[model samples]
Target: MVERVTATEETLQLLDKLKTIHGELMFHQSGGCCDGSSPMCYPRGEFRVGDSDIYLGDIGDTPFYMSKDQYEYWKHTQLIIDVVDGRGGMFSVEGPEGKRFLTRSRVFTEEERRELSIS
Candidate 1:
């Protein structure tokens, strides 16, 4: 059986704010520069699942998942969020310590978060 993971305080707040403004939120972790770790959040239907996907289950009406590879790399780290509001953006968590290789990231801004009661 697949193990279930609960969202963290930062992540849960971000999800709630996203839901209020964007209807539903989805999560994805893919390889990229800067230690090859990146986390993303967009409207529920905005993400496309790749072939090697690991299902992370639903957050209310939001369906969340990650690539099997991403799950393996980040299952043990803290989660952060990055929120985008049109051209404005904010990070839910940041700094050198919170940022690193194989680290969990979810960039969301304080303004966007507070505007949505997420911060």
Candidate 2:
């Protein structure tokens, strides 16, 4: 299957620890607020998602989403979620852990783009 979003090993480990404390989590990236470049993680049902958002698949079993406008610009690439030492966004769940979730990407290859009909 073509995965639109995936997480690094460090990210997965972080998510596991977070889940134990927060139950379930979800991620959203928007063009506004604190999500301009950072993927904000929230407890499930904590963040409201509407029609303006697009489901981008999951990372570490956590549902991921992006603003539709942001998706338009990012659809050509695959999202790779990683964790780094730093403070997270003010509203994100990872702030207390001293690690922030980061977004890294790779452009889709020709074959993958063709499979997704985006070539």
Candidate 3:
């Protein structure tokens, strides 16, 4: 099955480093203000996933989530998690590392959209 979310090799390596330091981690993307649009990394259970959030698969072993309303706008695309040189969200674990989690996306192909039942 096709994955709804994936990460680059660089990102995977960074995630490994983070996991060693922070233990289990998770990601959340929301539509609210204050870094909500950016993928925020937190130690698992540090961030709560509401019933309205959608699980978008994982990057390495880290589960990724999106707000239900945000998912509505992004469901037609595939999420590509990447790492960039910058300060991450203030509350994110990566903030002190000077590397941020970035979200890149591509519109799913017609075949993939059909397979995923995305209208």
Candidate 4:
């Protein structure tokens, strides 16, 4: 099956470091203004997932979610999580680490779209 979300090796390495320090982690992406458009990382169970949130799959053992409305606008693309040198969202766990999680994306191939349809 095609993954809706995946992370780069750099991102995975950072996540491992974060997990060692923060225990379990999770991610949420929203369509709200400012940092909300960026993915926010948090300690598991710290940020509640609402009924209207859509699970987009996991990256480095961390579950990724986005608001259903955001999903509607992003469904045709695959989310690629990467880490860049900078501060993350103010509320994200990685903010203090001087590295931020970045969301990159590409439109799914026709075959991938078909696979998703079949699923």
Which candidate leads in lDDT?
2
* Tens-digit lDDT track of model 4 for 1-119: 89999989999999999999999999998654332246899999999999999999999999999998878777888888888889867889998889999888888899999998723
What digit string (tens of lDDT, one per residue) describes model 3 on residues 57-106? Answer: 98998999998888877888888888889896799998888899888888
True-structure Cα RMSD, model 3: 2.5
Instruction: List model 1 lDDT by residue over 27-87, tens digit each.
Output: 6655543332445556666667878987766544455567776556555433433333222
TM-score of each: 0.49, 0.93, 0.93, 0.92
Candidate 2 lDDT score at position 26? 97
Model 2 clashing residue pairs (backbone) = none
Q: What is the lDDT of every predicted structure here?
A: 0.48, 0.88, 0.86, 0.87
lDDT of 1 at 94: 19
Number of the candidate with higher lDDT, 1 or 2:
2
lDDT of 4 at 25: 100
Number of clashing pairs, model 1?
A: 13
Name the regions of candidate 1 deviating beyond 4 angstroms. Answer: 1-4, 32-36, 59-61, 72-119
Off by over 4 Å in 3: 32-37
